[model samples]
Target: MEFNLTWILLGLPVAFVLGWLASRWDLRQVRADNRQAPKAYFKGLNFLLNEQQDKAIDAFIEAVQNDPDTSELHFALGNLFRRRGEYNRAVRVHEHLLSRGDLSRSDRDRAQHALAHDFLKAGLLDRAEDALRRLEGTAFEAEARLALLAIYERSRDWGQAAAIAGKMQQAGQGDFSTRLAHYLCEDAQTRMAQGQFDAARKLLEQALATAPQAPRPLLELAQLQQRCAQPAQALDTLENLARQAPASLPLAATLLVDVAQATGQQARVQGLLETQYRQAPSLDLLQALVALDQHIGVPDAPGRARLVQHLDHEPSLVAAAQWLQGETLAEEQYHPAVQKALDHAAKPLTRYRCAACGFEARQHFWHCPGCQSWDSYPARRVEEL
Candidate 1:
């Protein structure tokens, strides 16, 4: 074949031009893909900022499909799913991230934490507990422990709660002494209900040793002692409570009066209560004092005088009603109706109320039944507060 130099020279430039055009087409395609991904991502972000979560979720799904390798996009999608109550989808996303062997250690922990949260939100307590347990040695240990504590508390698993609280206390998270004591007291209550008196006593004793200054253990132990027919020991426990936790005396005043009468320690109790009343004249303590005076054969007139004295200090309607119940009114027939109305009005004022949740109860509670908050109710009654 004869060589054509002119044709060969023309064909070389044509081939070069074709190659350049192909390269330009590939670059433009890549730029378009990149632009589409960001556009979807920004659309999602705009939706989120506008609080349009459903629309944001759709946009994020589009962005994730366009950029499947982006871990942060996966996380955002998972969080959005969780927020929208799509817990199963959130679990799937986090589990996919966790399955990626190329994920960093920190990212794996984060994925695990997110998965635990998904389980929690889904009300899958067992799965949530397992996932949280796996985070024990991670930087999320403290947070995981706290969540576990809440779970245990909600489940009424006091032993587990105490163990986690002990760990958190050891880590210097905060002072969990009172919380630990409460757990012990709760456990003791369960044991007592099961007719395990000895075990219950031991648990309460341990609780007192754990937090000597905590009022609950002392009060619970005194009740246990009285139940065992050891009123003298119960009186001693209540005396210790009065000394260690004077602010909690009103809650224990009725118990004190009972134990004192049982143990023949009315004089001692009367003096202690008088001293406390001088410091903080609570209605409960005053009522106890009156009951004690009646028990010890004090004059009725003098005993009724105490309620009038309390009215001088607190301007309490409850006190006025109590005082009038024992009075000789000018119109004796009308007195009964007036006293009945006064008592009816003052009944609610005698109820104890939770300071945290405003839950009212006829009796004082160491823990709020409504909010599950410990020590949320003040010792004082509604009228006193």
Candidate 2:
């Protein structure tokens, strides 16, 4: 107001000095923050390497507070929460990362994948499935698909499993033909259980066509054919199975006998069994032959002799148990107890065992119940294995 030029010039330098001081203060504050964040991060790393998870988590929390924009810190914290069984916290952390608009594409995909794992670990299958589905077409696509396949299998959703498997197959992930065939066979079983025999047969046929070299579908189709009163067709299927997967004939021997009897092709089936036994010398084939002998009223001594001859090949306790059942020991009174003990010992050997998990079952399985592995259980019994 006074129009003093001297005072105006002095005021300009004062303002410049004040502005420089403010800038220095702000720079110091930022440098302090950067130094503190690294110190906290390094402390967390040290704690983690020392296996002190609780203290490490606390240090990481401090780091994250210092550098709230760090996505890697968030991921580390989320993974730690998951590993510590704090799935809810892990989910929240990952979800927060996903909600941020500034996240990179790869980081967002990572967050989604981590969230899905959290849901899966928490046993929230539906939520896990949804999260996993969002990861499709991302870098995690194959992993997501595999996890989805496991979920579908655990839920017995064979149709969904098949669809995922088909996608993976088309993607050239691996040869899923055997797995796809398993899904079809599983669906066929469900159809059979619902008394939809025609549909079941069609599914089994499709399974066979999908993987002709696979033994599971062939065995299932043969059994289904036998159940449908198509004895001739059943015999033909079993015959085809014997030719294609001769190693799996033990799994189908009893069915083959039944089919042979139903179709009055006993001699042909017996010939097939004899030929198979000569090639593989399976106890099951011998059992089927003995069954055939009994059906025709052959003398008991010959069956016992046949079992004795089996000792020349594989020294099977089961065969010895069978042979002892017909043998007249010196002490006939002790025969019952001896045979009972031997039979009991051999019964365990007759059970099928999963090669992968070592879970044993009285019946053979294409899919292992213990470890959820497909084709883990061999067609042969524990004794043969």
Candidate 3:
């Protein structure tokens, strides 16, 4: 019995010692693993700081392998891949992170956003939209919504764009009234094309109510009214536009003449044109005056004289060309060639210039074709501007 008790006591000490040694070995292994992860991470950071992207990626891969659970390392590697245009790899890393069970809420949201951006950059708009839509009610909601807005705009989905803009407006992101008005105007244009004039008119009216100061809806509404043979209403709409946004009157100047002739408001229209022309001698406004004078019984000599008078105020080749068209040239045989050259030279100057990008187009655009900015084209022509 004594011998058995002695063996038991010795076995207890030996077992405890073995357990202690095993624990120590495990602790050492864990420490080594932890140290290796940080070392690899630092090495990657050093490579990144030195702008050695290739080496940085290698080191980051090592770090990720060492500590696969590190969400931050995964995020960094994904972002690096995306920056290098390795969208496939970036997408994989971000998707893997998203699949991790241990990822925090914020980290998951971040990974989701990154993945969406990857898809967007990859031109997988459908996938990107789906990813972004999933981000609603998260911290990335605002950014996701903005991206969705851009997507809808690019696709020309006016109804969806308007709904998103409405939500953004309600959320107080910024004043989306003007943007909303544009969507309505776009919808109205489509309706007009589909032969739905009353619907178009109603939409335009709503647009005007949404943003009274916006010029596009008013201009489009006037055009719709004229197209439906509601010339008086069209004239009244344009008159309001002249009162509210005098600068944009030049855009509708030719239309103004037609509406005036149709509605028998020639005197009132002529006065408005002359007053506006005096305030701003745009070539377009001058053209409106010329048309109105011709329609009202003003003599051709006086009508041509108006262009000559404008030439003194602005050094406009366009005006000079117009004045020459009616003048009696001494070399009448060569007048055609000279006038043609002058008209050709004045054509580019008459184009509208984008205020944001300096892109010139023959037709004025509410939204710039070059930069996709709204209201980028000023009311004046390149020569006047």
Q: Tell me the TM-score of each prediction against the true structure.
A: 0.91, 0.91, 0.88
> lDDT tens string, model 3, 62-180?
99999998999998999889989999999999999999898899999999999999999888889999999999999999999999998888888988888888888889999999989
Q: Root-mean-square deviation of each candidate, in angstroms?
A: 2.5, 2.7, 3.4
Query: On residues 1-385, what C-alpha lDDT tens digit does candidate 2 reach at each position?
Result: 6788999899999999999999999999999999999999999999999999999899999999999999989998998899999999999999999999999999999999999999999999999999999998999999999999999999999989999999998999999999999999999998999999999989988988899899888788888878888989888888888889899899888997898789888899999999999988988999999998887678887677789899878889999998887778898999999999999999999999998999999988888889999988877878888
Model 1: per-residue Cα lDDT over 1-385, one tens digit each: 9898999999999999999999999999999989999999999999999999999999989998988888888899999999999999999999999999889999999999999999999999999999999998999999999899988998999989999999999999999999999999999999999999999999999999999989999999999999999999998888899899999988889988998889899999999899999999999999999999999998987778898888878899998998888889888999989998999999999999998899999988877889888899889999988
The number of clashing residue pairs in each candidate reads 0, 0, 0
Task: Note the Cα lDDT for every prediction shown.
Answer: 0.93, 0.91, 0.91
Evaluate model 3: give its lDDT: 0.91
In model 3, the Cα lDDT at residue 117 comes to 96
